[model samples]
Target chain A: MNVFLQELRSQRRSTLIWSLSLAAFGSLYLLLFGAIRNDISAFEDVLKNFPPVAQAALGFVIGTLKTVSGFYAFAFTYIVLCGAIQAANLGVGAIGREIGGSTADFLLTKPRARWSILAQKALAVLVLLVATNVVLLAVTIPVAAAQGPDFDAGLFVLLSATMFFVQVIFASLGLLYGVAAKKVKSVVAVSLPGVFAFYIVGLLGAVVGEDAIRYFTPFKYFDIGYILKNAAYETGFCLVAVAVVVVAVGASFAVFAKKDVQAL
Target chain B: MNVFWRELRANRKSLIWWCVGMVLMIYAGMAKYAAYATSGTSIADLMKQMPASLSAALGFAGLDVMKASGFYGMLYLYLLLMVAIHAALLGANILAKEERDHTSEFLMVKPASRSRIVTAKLAAAFVNVTVLNLVSLGLSFAVVEQYAAGENMTDEILLLMGAMFIVQLVFLFLGSAIAAVGKRPRSAASLATTVMLVTYVVSIVVDINKNLGFLRYLTPFKYFAAAPVLDRMGYEPVFVVLSALIIVASVVVTYLAYDRRDLKL
Candidate 1:
């Protein structure tokens, strides 16, 4: 209980920054929807002139750039990118900082069991992430509706909710990396590359038109284009995301329980 | 001189990893171009098939993306991203690592002056980015040419790489400037990367919304946009002057800030 609260309190500043940034992107872009809608034909011509490959790389979808939901869904890719970084940072820092900062000795010597410690840390990250998503939803949904087009409220919620789903998957992988690494000198170093590698994987998969490759990268699990059409996520990918969380979080506990903190 | 060589030797392993990573990235990226080139459709027609939604999404598409130059021009955006990140992290970490690793005292106690050390470390970072740039240039030449199908796209690739070098230099100095000015040694790299990301987002937003075209001044990415540079338009003169200003200012800031700060230890 103490560790959970302490973790939340310690991480309050970064959490707030990430939440605000996420919420800001949602509001800022949707507000622009009105201005852009007035000049749709001109905007379409400009988009046509931009490179196709670059468009795919930026997660732009051609079929839906005209609508509010579609535009926000497109902008939501950048949001997901940011949220993944924050999640990865939080997860890696959860246990990695204790070992890296050489504070594991003091923390481990306390009376709590190792599993209990891990549980509290994981729970704190979950709470923080949920709070971020709530803040994002609260800001984005209302602004999106106010754009006055036929806003698909249900679909917008579905698309926005994927932020949490992606965050959970990355956070688990980050935690596992945190526990498995011998000692981490810098949390950003580990998390940033991991996030970018997956991102590029998703981008390349789109470039090659290879749907099978999507399974390898979490970024592909929630396709904004597909969701814009089908109004749902791929069942297979969602299960894969769940499996990843289960395996990674489970492995973190197993390794962390037996690990010797004194060796570092 | 010893400080420069020592910095090079210390950064050797990571540079090798960066090289390997760049090689794979180029290969993977060019592989897409090869697939596009041979798909039995003339590159021009294939591109014609792709809808001009970006015009719908934001502005004008002028490049003939079916050509080797056009495809490579598109690919350069991704390359710019990688190099920008490497330069930013390299610049921030080169100085800040000493403090983070608690070796600032050991280095500061050396016979060299603080400016001399900064120059040496920055020189090493210079070499690192140069090698990475050349590696990209060489591989881009090889792969983009393969798909060039005898069109002689070398000049196009060179122009793009040249622009890429300037972008890398801008970010490297920007990173060093942030590290030198920041109070916390550990947060220097994060701050540098954050600055890099914000500018990148600004560039993207500008690309998507021409109304924000004024923001081109704020980001290095817009200074030499791939499509414009590859189109024989070349780097905009105004952005060229801005890049130069940023580089010179950052160098001055780094020297002035690092010289006066007390060592963390």
Candidate 2:
């Protein structure tokens, strides 16, 4: 645990940068939301005019754009993209740097089990992700409140909580890529394509009106819009997100444990 | 030359993966076409039913909505923008990775002149992009011929492909030159990526908002309009000339910078 804490301390700068960036994206969305707050009816008119297929493709559901949560769902993809990039950058560098610098073997020689080292590094990444999401929530909540009392606080809280789990799933994806790829550059290749594929699947489903394909995209499970409307997540997607974390993290540990290392 | 060849060969898997990915998108596109074709509605009719706003978002103005070539124009531009960026970055980074790997000293110590070494590396990067583009084009045509047969083809489709191919070459060569001059490979990669991304954003913003039109001319991406290219009017000679000048200037700058610089890694 001390080693895990130490790793977190070592990553303080990266953590701060990611946290600030996530907050910035959240703040940008909120600012835009505020700009349009006075003219909700005009916005509704725009949404109403969209073709159903196009609306679905863009996740611009009718009658939802006026609510804070609705706006959140509308802008969720951009925020998630930013968050996912943060997690991917962390995963690519965290382990690969140790290997690149020839410090992995030296670290392994310490009074630590391989599992402990892996666990601690993973914990550091998780903490960073959580901290970023927390900062995002911290800023977004007050902004939502300032908008109106009718804002669904319960749904807002639930959506924010889901972001934590969402980040973990994506971070684990990055870690898995880190473990499997031989070079750090390959980590970005894996994460970017993987995220894009999921997004594309979600889009395909939305455009084709096929709920079945939605199951393939993590975005569908999170359903920022649904959570905002119902104050809860899709139960099945929550389970899938948890399952993804368990499988990816377990697989990453298994791979990292056996990989060859050289000491500086 | 040997080192360049080595890096190019090492990237074979990546090249193959990229080719397959693009071909798969084309397949998906053909599927979209098939769905429309089977509905007994002519391509023009189906397209006419699409909402004006949606068509605007999808970049359909001045494009034939009913033809295979038109669909290709609408979809291929976005896909190729992304693919070409990937290819350019890959081409640039692989050329500089030897230094990043601390193997540049071994490679650079050969009896060949520094200019020859740099030229070989740049040549290899060019060849990589050229081959990838050719493969993607070949696969796209194959799919168009086999699946979307008897469709009205346009000169615009050819021009679109040609413009994208040239754009890929410019970006790849420009990025390679930037990489060669930079002291750190990671910095080089970041710089190249940032430049390309900023250019794309500028180009898009300019197109979407008429107020930003004046800023468009500054970005290399704005040189070839998707509408014009898809219309098969051929590239504006001015843009082609500008791209060539930029490519030549970048190459010269790289050669000058690298000739005097020392490799530390």
Top candidate by TM-score? 1
In candidate 2, stretches whose alpha carbon ends up further than 4 angstroms from where it belongs are: A1-75, A134-166, A180-190, A193-220, A223-231, B33-70, B145-151, B198-210, B214-225, B236-242
User: Which of the CAPRI classes, incorrect, acceptable, medium or high, describes model 2?
Assistant: incorrect
Off by more than 4 A, model 1: A35-62, A206-209, A262-264, B34-53, B56-62
lDDT of 2 at A174: 75
DockQ each candidate and list the results: 0.24, 0.17
Report the lDDT of model 1 for residue A241.
Answer: 93
Per-residue CA lDDT of model 2 for A163-217, tens digit only, reads 6776677778777777666656433444555665565555464236557866676
The number of the candidate with the highest lDDT is 1
State the lDDT at B41 in candidate 2: 36
Q: How close is candidate 2 to the true structure, as a TM-score?
A: 0.78
lDDT of 2 by residue, B107-202 (tens): 778898878887877777777777767776776677676545676454555666677777786777677777777777755665575567557656
* Interface RMSD per candidate (angstroms): 7.1, 7.5
